[model samples]
Target: MKKTLLSLLAVVTCAYSAPALASGGTEAPPHVHWEFSGPFGTYDRAALQRGLKIYREVCSSCHAVKHLAFRNLTDLGYNEEQVKAIAAEYTVTDGPDEDGEMFERPARPSDRFPSPYPNENAAKAANGVAPPDLSLIVKARHHGANHVFGILTGYEEAPEDHPLADGQHWNKYMPGHVIAMAKPLSNGQVTYEDGTIETVEQYAQDVAQFLAWASEPDLEARKRFGISALIFLAVFAGVMYRLKKAVWKDVH
Candidate 1:
């Protein structure tokens, strides 16, 4: 009787834990205010630059911003020479000699950011799952900048009732409360030349803003255009209303 009761209790425990793990039950990411949050908002150039530094020194090992070009760094306040210097730091495969074999050379301003792995298979082999390209990540996620920030800083110890498998980590904001990628940021992980705070929260905020700019470099311009169009339409409507009154007054 005792053995049968122990087996039943074990089965009950597994059954109870299975649903919680499978359901994900992730908490909503905390809200974070951003310079680029509203229609009149614009990207903070200094923050974007700092975020780029973080990406280069840390995130680049596993993630790629394949849609971004070295030349595009100019939008974040880097000059042409600085952009060239940054591009030359990386090597890219290019060209076919007379033998028609691919050759490797320093990256050019025109080249898109290269992937750390040669191909998807290699990336998956190295990491279990391929890290998504970060170029459009801010726009792609539901909460945009806040979501990125949450993931970067959300690492925490698992609850006593919840145990993680090998290679899995607990993230407060991750769906299912588990993530494959370890916490990517730590306090003072990247130095900032501009004297910005070097805490993990600061890094997460700066990188989140940088990803926002990457996802929408023209956000300010688009907002300007939209505002201009709205103003034009409002004025046009007023003028048309006056004309209608002038024209119909005589008829009445």
Candidate 2:
């Protein structure tokens, strides 16, 4: 009877834990699986710059990463002076000028990243849906990199029984399946300084990595932490081994 009761308790525990794992119940397409690993690889500075250019020119039209300020560019491979110069290239609003009218001036590091629209209603009016904020998207979503890359590259025309009508697409399992965003990448779309062909697949992968980098700017710090942890474990093991040898010497 005790063994049967223990088995029942184990089953109940599993049932309770299942909900926690499935918290982000949002469904994705069939070509992907929910995972936590980010874009675990290195990126070339030139490719990253090109990807940023693509983002600023194309994707920025619909999405925004409000947490990122213009000054944040310094964190990415660039030097501080270069970051300031880049910021100066953009105009931002300041208080009234001598004429008592709001005026624009070169962007400052302290300024927040600008949004495509002034507010939610304006954004919805233009796109028919609210563009999701991308501040922590890479960290929040499952299979983040693969999901981002897959969605960017997996866009296709509608299929029979698709949730969206004819000419509208529905991936096998996406929420509405009919994502409003259209495919933005094309072969040789924006020629890269590195001479890498700008294919849709490459664009997707590079942009996904760039987004992952943005989400966790302290990635190098995490790498340092791992190295420290490994050293500590090795020293701990050595001390334990020496103590065991000393203690068992009398037994032998």
Candidate 3:
């Protein structure tokens, strides 16, 4: 026990003394109070629809959501007919007929969202850096939606002392404060159907929430199951407690 205590103390001392490897230039991402944050939270369908519009009209040019299918839009309060119409807006490559030739067709509800660039090389050639797939980005990083929201709204001018690399933009929330992508959102960038204010912050929050949904499509169902399981466990525990009390009461 003495040796174990000493060893544990030594380890704790080492951990405290060790230098953390960190990017010194970046600031922590700003936190947003999201509607779908907690276990019982649910998504606002109106915000999600607006977010989809932002992605389709603005972010789609450079970013791609290959993991998302057109049918998934139904979760954003879109009906079958509306989803089909939205899907038809994009053209997707299709297989050959009897001739075994590839063809292009209007994307169907079943089709995955088309990538903006054909390949990584193509994306790099076009954008100088490969644009990341947004399908799971909100869940991919620490702080999830809050981090993404910060990135979208964090652009600013660099101070004179800090020089940014060519093609790199200063993003307050980005590690090293240098990001390849410029600020994507602006005031009035997306006119919401529900007449929500069109500010960069609003756009960022909505889009981040939408990305979170994409990352966890079954979040609501999963939470429901968790609640049901907890209830079942509680009932089981009560029954077990009662049985124990009844069996042991006479002896005690």
Candidate 4:
């Protein structure tokens, strides 16, 4: 019995420690309060807009939100003309013409965000590893928003014991404590028109929120529907109870 208990303890320890070990003793991401967290939460339009700016100015050079369409900007409070203007900024490759030749055209609201590179090989050649698409990144990563925020702000000097290669960077939240991407955000890197403080932490937080919204654009609607359903159920339950009392009162 003692041996069996010891075996169970070993298994639990291994299961708990394996992730840390795999990540080279990387620390867990810190919790961040998000506007869209609770059941009554909704995406902040201002923050989403700011995040869009960051992605366009900084992240768009490498990463693409391929799963998102220009039309989807409406969810961020952009109007029809505004969305069209934004879409026009990008060039998209379209279908073959009558002569069997693909043509380039200004992107429309229906078009997906184009990748920076023409192909995977080009992206890999440029960045070593092709940057992952940001469309579903929030849903893809564990503790999505917080993890992303941690990574963006986690860069620091490596300890004497841990050396890094030429292209590698040290990040407190990164697995293995080594990352290929350098610190991307800097103080005052992007100017904000809304008079929001322009800092690395603020940028990280805004972009994380934006990515979260992107991952689940219907989050607000879904929550609203759920709340309505619950209310309806409660009302129906109450009405049914009263009707039962009325119908069975005489018999009882």
Q: Which candidate gets the maximum lDDT versus the true structure? A: 4
Error of 2 at 162 (Å): 3.6
Flag the better candidate by lDDT, 1 or 4: 4
**Over the stretch 21-115, how does candidate 1's per-residue lDDT look in tens digits?**
76576666889989987888888999999999999999999999999999999999999999999999999999797899999999999999889
> Candidate 2 — worst ten consecutive residues by lDDT sum?
29-38
Task: Please identify which of the two predictions, 1 or 2, would achieve the higher TM-score against the true structure.
Answer: 1
**Candidate 3 positional error at 59, Å:** 0.8
lDDT for each residue of candidate 4 in 50-162, tens digit (9 for 90 to 100): 99999999998988888989999999999999999999999999989999999999999999989998988898788877888899999998679998899999999999998
After TM-score superposition, the amount by which residue 130's alpha carbon in candidate 1 deviates from its true location, in angstroms, is 1.5
Which parts of model 4 are misplaced by more than 4 Å?
1-21
Write down the lDDT of every candidate, Cα atoms only: 0.90, 0.69, 0.89, 0.92
Summarize candidate 2's per-residue lDDT along 1-252 as a digit string, tens digits: 999999999999999867445543435533432222334434455555665776776778888878888677766677878777777877778888888999888887778667778799888777777777766777876656667776777666676564564334544233445766666677778667777777887777667666776787677667667778999999999999999999999998
What TM-score would every model get versus the actual structure?
A: 0.88, 0.76, 0.91, 0.91
Q: Which residue segments of model 3 deviate by more than 4 Å?
A: 1-20
lDDT at 176 for candidate 4? 77
Per-residue lDDT over 1-252 for candidate 3, one digit per residue giving the tens place of the 0 to 100 score = 999999999999887644222556366688788888688989989888888888998899999998999999999999999999999999999998679999999999999999999999999998888989999998788669988998998899997898987888988888777889989888986778787999999999888889999999899999899999999999999999999999999999
Ranking by TM-score: 3, 4, 1, 2
Question: Model 1, residue 54: what's the lDDT?
Answer: 91
